[model samples]
Each structure stands twice: as structure tokens, then as C-alpha cells.
Target: MSPCSSVPEAAESVSRFTERPALQSSKTLRAAGVWTGAQQTRLNVRHFEFTADEPHKVGGRDQGPTPMEYLAGAVNSCITVVIDQLAARQQLTLEDLQTYTLASQDTRGLAGTADVQPYAHAYRLQIAITTPERDEHTLRQFAARAEHICPAINLLRDANTGLKVVWSFTEQPTAEAAERLSNAAVGYTEEHDAPKPFLTVTNADLAASVSA
Candidate 1:
């Protein structure tokens, strides 16, 4: 189901908690993954199942999104849902909403580089929303609220990752605007430094070591 489809129900649910603080409670979410083979794994969350794998060049079957891609998607989806719920609560009409997320990590960290961290060091969240609210202040307020409350966003923020959020507000959607947003989303990643291996060890060096 589309994330927006649950907005009304989620908004009502949140309202109940606000009206009665006693309704609030913490819940734990869980997922498990089993290594299948060659950098691939099968994951289970609740009753849903999916696969995670590296690309063929990275020595996997290229079956599904890599783990980092999933992390970026999680951030995007969580913030989108929060915006939808907030709009419902605020009585704002949202004609459309979309988010694009890009995470930048140093692959050198994965290869055991001492100074580099294995996880994403920075993230960019690009949001485009079509809403009737024309006041820039009101739109900024809404964006701030969503950023403050989004769980996935906070997770990376708490870890000290540099997060840049870019928002575009429009009274109506346009194909030209969407194309620009899409290009901007990709540009953020392209403009950033690309991930590169730090280790000088080559495949031949590893093979010689193994033979010796």
C-alpha cells in the first residue's frame, strides 16, 4: 500500500495519544537475515521476506538492493510518512509529496581503514511537496516538524552523520519541476566525493599470499 493511504488512520491514532498520554507505549521492531551465498542474504521481517545482495561486480548475484540502499530508503520512507501524517493533522491539502535520499559512505572503512568509518558519513534528503499552503514560513514550520519527529532521520543524526535536507514547496505539481527535482537528487550524490578503496592490496597479491 502507498504510504499516503495510511495517513488518515495514522493521524487519528496519533491524535488519540496526544489527547490521552496514557495511550503511548514503546514497541520493538525486529528483523532477521540469513546468509545464503556469495554476499547475498535472505531477510525476514514479521511475515515479509526479501533478499539483499551486492552487485555482480561486487561478487554477488545482483538480486536486490544492497544494505546501504535499504538504509537510505528507510530514511526516505519514514520522513514521507511523517509528512503525510502531519499534513492530515494540520488540515493541509497535499496534492503530492516525494522524497529522494542519498547516503555517502567511504568504502575504505569497510576494508578496515583505521581512520574511516564503515557507515555513511553524510546524507542528503530532497523533498518536493505540492500543497495549497503558499506561505514559506508555514511550509518551513511543517518541514521542521517532520524533521524533528522522524525516527529514521534521528537515527543517523544521533550517529553524527552530516544530514542536508532540501525542500521545495509548490501549489501545484508540474512535470518540468519533477524532472528538475529528480536531476537535483542525483546531482547531490554526483557532486560529492565518490567512494574508493583505500587498500593497496591487489587480487594478484592476495592470490600469491594464499599460494605461499
Candidate 2:
């Protein structure tokens, strides 16, 4: 539950956001990555950096995760979050959730054999979740609806990528499991603590000082 729930008008306003364009603001999101050779690349996010690489089997040095792995995880992560948020608004109690996403890409395009070697020739998402307050039918309906809310889903579908979603519910197990799920259920209940900045800059100092 969100802190806004305490104020009916505030909660309603939050819900009203759903009817508006998600990216209605003129603000833009950005990230930059640099290739480090041998299928290795370094990604830079605000004050953060991580390496990405492919396995030796695919002519890489196996320094880190492959791009496909990152894509699969990104899709799953985004949708799982969508499910959590959507269910919360519906007043459903989710106990446990896990998702597995699979996608296949054709290297033919990379090799110049085809114009498109879509990241996923075929895709499958298997979601196993537990929402104790809602029946299977209701949960399924919400799950499908949440899929449509996912930005990742929109990207994949728009690219004409083949995708499938399969989900099932199971009783949540263990106290730790319940606690973990509870944490996820609790949405942002507080205002932003970080000094919010809206800008694009070449360095951290300038970014922190300016609002664009």
C-alpha cells in the first residue's frame, strides 16, 4: 500500500495518471555504453557502471552476461514490477512471484544472410505467482492486463517479436518468502529523498548543479 492511500483524493489522482500518456513530459531518459572489445562493453548509468560480455562459445571472452540475457532479465523485471503495482491497486495480496523469460535470436542478420535477425525469433515468459486474495481467474486477468502495461512488452511487440506469457500460482512458502513478497507489495510510500535533477550533462558535478 502507498502512503497516498491515506488521502482519498491523492490516491485517486495517482489512479488518474493511468489515463494519461506515460511520457507526457518533455523529459528524456538516457544512458551510454562503451565497447571494450572482445564482446565486452561497459554501461554507464547515473553514477553507476557495469560490464556486459558474451561467452567464449560465441567468440566472446565470457567476461560478463550476454546482451540477450540482459534483455530477458529486463523484460521479466519490468513485468514483474508491473504485476506488483497493478495488483496493489486492485487490492490483491501477492505472496510470492517469480518469472522466467526465454527468447531466441537468429545470427543470420549479423552474418549478412538476412536483414533482420530479430533478438527473438520466438519468446516465452513463464510467470509463477501467488496472490492469495484473488482467485486464479482474477489473478490471470490482472496478469494479462499487467503485460500490456509493461514498456518492455510494448517494445518487443512493436518490433514484431514473437512473445508468449504463461503463468501459474502456487502457495507461498516460508516466512522469508512472505516477507520478501510483502516488501515488493509495498509501493513507494515516501517522497523522493534524492535531490531531483532533470538534465543531461557530461559529468556528475554539472548534472547535480543544473536542472534542465
Candidate 3:
């Protein structure tokens, strides 16, 4: 029997068929008692309290991931899981996998200023892998397979997708906290204050670094 048809027709049982298929539209592929819809393969995420050593200290890091950071983490973890599964099936021992995901979201979308709701304008990803005894050809094949099997990649690329904002809240900022943050150097946000006039203490002391 094909993958779409199986005994014990239930939601959990049907979930097994969520793997990347042969790229056939539901209309093109007809199977009796088969359900294929966005709801059938929806991606859900839950948040937990972030904990890290000395998270609240001025210089101490939070050691835990933020929500936006987890978005990128999901892509990397999905690709890694797919690669590991395929490698195990092929009797290939995995060494290490590295995936880099960069997503540029329009804040206007998040701020409800844009017509689009998802806020995801575009996402770019690069995967670098280091495996023992695996040649470049084999690595490329694995990479392609991983891309095909990753569910997050599929959902991100799906045309009929929407970003579901379940819940959001704002925290009141304290006066001390506000002042400290406001004193920081202006990099991305608009610079309303003018720079102080200063004489050339040292002419051409150091070359300036340009940043976007």
C-alpha cells in the first residue's frame, strides 16, 4: 500500500505522512479517505521560561534563547534531525552539522503597519557540514535531502501560509531602566541628539569603521 493509505485512520496515524512527498498537489493526487490540508500539517510552537546563569546582570548573558532566536533555531534543528535520520538509514556515521539561518523581517509587518501579517519578508540559509570519510558529492546529496525533508523549510516556503500571533503583551519599563537604555549609542534607531563638537585630538588617529 502507498504511504497515503494505511490502516487505523486517525489524526496521529495520518501525521506519519507529513514527510516531504514527491511534490504532487492534493488535487493531482487522489487517494480514498486521504486528508491533505494546511491544518493537517500546521507548525506549532510553545514558549517556556528562559533561564541562564546571571541573566539579569549588566554584563551577564541570558544563556537562553529568545522567541525570534528560536525561529532560526527551529530551521537548524529540523535540518539536523532530517540529516541524522537519513544518515542512519544509509548506514553513515554523522560527524557534525552546521546550519546558519538569517531572516530579515519587516518591523512594519509586526507593528501592523504593513498589509502582510507574517512579517517574514525573506529568509536566507546556508548549511555547512563536516563529516568523517564523506566526500563532497555525498555531502551535497545529504544537504539536498535534508532540505527536502525539513518541515520548517516547507512551511516557510508554502504560499498559503499565515503567521499566527497567538498572544503578545508589553512590560512597563522603570525610569532607571529607561534612562540606561536611552544613554546607549545609537546604531539602528534614529539619532535625534547632535554629536558634541570636539577638536582633532589626534589627526587620523584610527580609521573609521563603516556599518549599516
Best-matching candidate per TM-score: 1
Q: Cα deviation of 166 in candidate 1 (Å)? A: 1.2
TM-score to native of every candidate shown = 0.72, 0.66, 0.44
lDDT of 3 by residue, 1-212 (tens): 34444233334423323443342432232323212232121222233333322233423345554445666677668866876798898766654444555566766764576777454665544343334533544544454455545677656655323321110011321232212222332233333331221111110101111110
lDDT of 1 by residue, 1-212 (tens): 23232223333323212342222343447889999999999999999999999999879899999998988888888988998999999887898777776667988888786678789887767677777777655665676667667888756766657776767776666554433554545674342232221111112212333554
Question: Which residue ranges in model 1 land beyond 4 Å of their true spot?
Answer: 1-24, 175-179, 185-212
Better TM-score candidate (1, 2): 1
Determine which window of 10 residues in candidate 3 has minimal summed lDDT.
203-212
Off by over 4 Å in 3: 1-65, 133-137, 159-212
- Pairs clashing within candidate 3: none
Best by lDDT: 1
lDDT, candidate 2, 3-98, per-residue tens? 232322333323312454433332455678998898799998788888889888878888777887888888889988888898779877876777
How far in Å is the alpha carbon of 2 misplaced in model 2?
A: 28
- Residue 48 of model 3 has an lDDT of 31
Please give the lDDT score for candidate 2.
0.60
